[model samples]
Target: MTDANTTAFTNPSTFILLGIPGLEVAHVWISIPFCTMYVIAILGNFAILFIVKREPSLHGPMYYFLCMLAITDLVLSTSTLPKILAIFWFNSREIDFSACLTQMFFIHCFSEIESGIFAAMAFDRYVAICHPLRHSTILTNSLVMKIGLVILLRGSILILPCPLLARQWPYCRTNIIPHTQCENMYVVRLACADTRISSYYGLFVLYCRIGLDVSFIILSYIQILRAIFSLPTKDARLKTFGTCGSHICVILAFYIPTLFASLTSRFGHNLPRYFQVFISNVYLLVPPMLNPVIYGVRTKEIRNRLLRLFTHKGTKAFSSGVGPQTDLPGVAGW
Candidate 1:
């Protein structure tokens, strides 16, 4: 009996994704919202990129950071949504081992990249609000490009080891992943061999990237708030806060669920399987769908441009001086 049981388990070429485990019956129904969110994420992020690129007025550091964010959101959501939809719609649960690793890498790497972008955006807001006169000079085009490269490299370099380590493990137990997508720990936990190295390395990467990013973001915001309160009039403070509204919303949208999901995955071993899966999916899907909406609604510049685009008005050609400079001392054409 022991020999037969041992013989039944072997290294699998493909891993099976179980969509939602105990909630299998609701896969189709649950997919409707997931599919809707994915579509919105794609269209909304692309539209943001298009609007920012075409509207010369938005060629500032804030918008440039926003464009990076939109691009990251696009890659992050695209990495997993299609497979999730396939599992729900067509029952195509089998994912090649290589493909699963690739998906895991993109999902995690881009998530860290997205977090880094958020940190960059926070710095942009800090400079725009705290040192408005030096905003452009400090965040020059060259500096922005460098920041992007650093963010990309940080995420890729730190997360590269996760998949490489997972690849080295011997998965002789089972190939069935209970969640929808190939999360790092989920994949590593299936290994029949010692997983301590991979597990510790994952924690290290998480602290090195996300923990530091969050800390910096909080510091930036605190400094920004202090700067805002130093203004003499209530109206000035209010305007500055209004300018920061979109960014604060976007930051919360991305980090809250991400931190919750990560903590739950690490410590909530007693939680129901379906609940865990649902939260993980929400962490991936919610931010991308909401970011564009939050920015479009809260940012007057983007909103007006979007309205003009849909109204068939002729958009002025791209030019550095075309955008009208604002009168607010601490707000740089926000």
Candidate 2:
């Protein structure tokens, strides 16, 4: 209303993130669990990447797609958690305007890239199951490289406009973001100018880009299931199911919390602020923590490799002459 008030709002150089409102006093106490989870996510994903790189047996399409997924998870978690931890530990929540936009860009870009990787994984599964004889020929290293490029381009190009559009709108009232991260919608809501275009474009990207990928993933699974059921013996059916179980679990883990968080943010207007923030963290953090665990447990190769890794480390520490044992079940066989 007054020039003094307008100047006060527009002249602010940095925006403050109100990390988990009403729990400000317990920020330090609450950060312990989050710190532990972040460590696990980073270490677990990195281990997957390392195992795939070192093992010659894992140089196929499935494992390559997995490496891509691990990389995406690493980037996605790193983009959001550092600032959150800083807020909780050191009370550092001030982010410059351009810095905030940069954070927003990477957050959305890597999310889309992760979704695309999931779709690529689904297609790999489909080809392997539906056309076993042709799998190697169809999904060669060259094709994988091309697909990776397309996925990276799709996400980077589509997400570039989101922050660009948001930065054009001027903020004149408050710069306090309610969430820990600089999410696109949360940042756009702070703008005093019309934000209908930004809001609609965000929705468009969600439904058109991520939504299409999800649909194709479901369709690929359906076709794979059809092919598997046509096999003659029960043993064959069980073997096929075993091969796909880990991927199914990973897909469920990623999509369920994400959808729940999106719905809660949109429709749970009467819900407490902390509930919304909790779900948002769950959506962003849970996949990176759980994906490696699922793969290591369900996939025999990864589990054996991890076991050998630790065993070898232990042997070297205790005795220079002793070597790591390889008599574990599923180590010699597939």
Candidate 3:
């Protein structure tokens, strides 16, 4: 009888994604804001890439890292948003088994990579402020490339097991995922077989990667703050703090929603299902949408380059002696 029951297990070839449980009627209205944010995220991240690539002066470790970050945000958001929008708009909820696993992998993997990039950016700020003399020597372009490769490899390796483990589960239960996307835990819970192993493995990977990155980021900022305060003049101190302000804002924007969503998923089962769904969606949408905006508004170099890009006609008039010429060498054609 036991062997017969075990042999009776069947895995569905496709899973249906519920856009948001208990809010099916509002999917269209809800997609408006989500669609808006997704559009902004795409355009903003691409703009960052374009400006950084066009300007040679922005070719330092910081902007290089920013470019990598922009690319990561692009991929991270692109992975889930389009399918989510389709689910919302067309009520297209069916996802193939392999496709679901692929989506799961991309969402989690790039998120970890993005977190690592934040740590890298924090370290860049620390070196630039705390050890100005060594900043140039330490974070050369080649070294930054190596760091990026290591981050990519580490995140990919760590998250690869999640979907692989998930795929091994005997999902004899129903194939309906009660969320917009194939979130690891949500999908794993659909297995009729015991899922503690998969659940614990996912948790273990999350804590180890995110915890290590967070610790490194915190320590970097602590040393950076100390260095900022040690500056003799108030102006120097403020100026130094200003340099880190954008990165700090971006870090908070990224981590706060992520941590909240993570906690809500694990511990806030008593919370409203809709609220949990909302926060999970927010977690994926907000950072990518806000990151480029924060940097464009706060970072002088990037901001100025953006202004130059959009206002090149006015810049041309000014360069013709109608006003002061603020054009730099590499930015002439832009």
Candidate 4:
């Protein structure tokens, strides 16, 4: 490469993140909702973790996975939004190259971890419904810990190369990333070097790892549906479906916007830049915000626990003189 082509890599200092490129005038206004969503995501996920930890009855494979999911959501949102808000609020768009890469690594790693947790939760549901008698024996505490470890390891190891590959590239072109976050493709495209390998590897990781996880989740649901249908009573079917409803909502919330954003980035090349950035931001922010809401509303145990937590702070005893039910519907086998 020419001297000019090597300049950025040699004196790598900072990268500019273009927050909502064409909407510079509206960034302050736009930040209102973004800030709201960030607060909601943080508080919501924290509540999930708090509820799971405090409620002894929630100690099970399903709630264990829910805790993992909450942690992942917290990490994922925290990894991206602080920088985004800074850019929007203060126009502090320049990020150190190393810092940018580090942010990208964490963003991708936590995202993949969430995907894996979703798949694990689906399997938990499968075991609970399709093999109820074996559920306890199968998803013991040891197995839960092992699965969590495997999910963490899988994301951390696979995502290591993403930042490494970006660091190796000589970014001689303009160092402006046209999105709020340091997504892999956005950063790779700014490199002066040929990025075919990086692009292909990113696609490989997406399809092979996340794709595989999504497929397993789908298959688990299929088996779960079969088992639900096999039950003779309508009440059994409805109860089983109700047990899975929150999970289904969470899965759809996580994946649909992500798929839409991915497809638009790949194929909607002619679409307006601001629209693309909007969708990308939506993909990251919406899932974290919605997850806890879905669970709190759909899962009775979590809802009651959350209610009791708030109510207890106001009074010494229940107003109705009835304690919260300890034998609430279990998450896995309700």
Off by over 4 Å in 3: 1-9, 313-334
On lDDT, the candidate that comes out on top is: 1
Instruction: Rank the models by TM-score, top first.
Output: 1, 4, 3, 2
Counting only residues 3 or more apart in sequence or on different chains, how many pairs clash (N, Cα, C under 3 Å) in candidate 2? 0
Per-residue lDDT, model 2, residue 326, is 31
Clashes of each: 0, 0, 0, 0
Q: Write candidate 4's Cα lDDT for 170-256 as tens digits.
A: 876677788998889899988777989888888877885558989999899899899889989898788777788888888888888
Model 3, span 1-334: residue lDDT tens: 2342344456778888888999999999999999999999999999999988987767778888889999999998999999999999999999999999999999999999999999988888888777777777888899999999999998899899999988988888578888999999888988878889888988887786568999999999899889778888898787667677888888889888988888898899899888888898887889999999988888767777788799774565434434223212111111
Name the 10 consecutive residues with the lowest summed lDDT in model 1. 316-325
Which candidate gets the maximum TM-score versus the true structure? Answer: 1
TM-score of each: 0.94, 0.90, 0.91, 0.92
Ranking by lDDT: 1, 3, 4, 2
Query: Relative to the true structure, how large is the alpha-carbon lDDT of every model?
Result: 0.85, 0.81, 0.84, 0.83
Off by over 4 Å in 1: 1-10, 314-325, 329-334
Give one digit per residue, the lDDT tens place, for model 2 in 1-334: 1342345466356778889977889889878888888899899999999988987767877888888888888998898899999999888988988889999999889888888888888888888788777778899988988898899999999999998998888888788888888888888888888999998898888785448988999899899889879988888777775677888888888888777776776678888888888888887888988888888887776786788788775444333433233322111111
Clashing pairs in 2: none
Model 1 C-alpha lDDT versus the unseen true structure: 0.85
Clashes counted in candidate 1 amount to 0
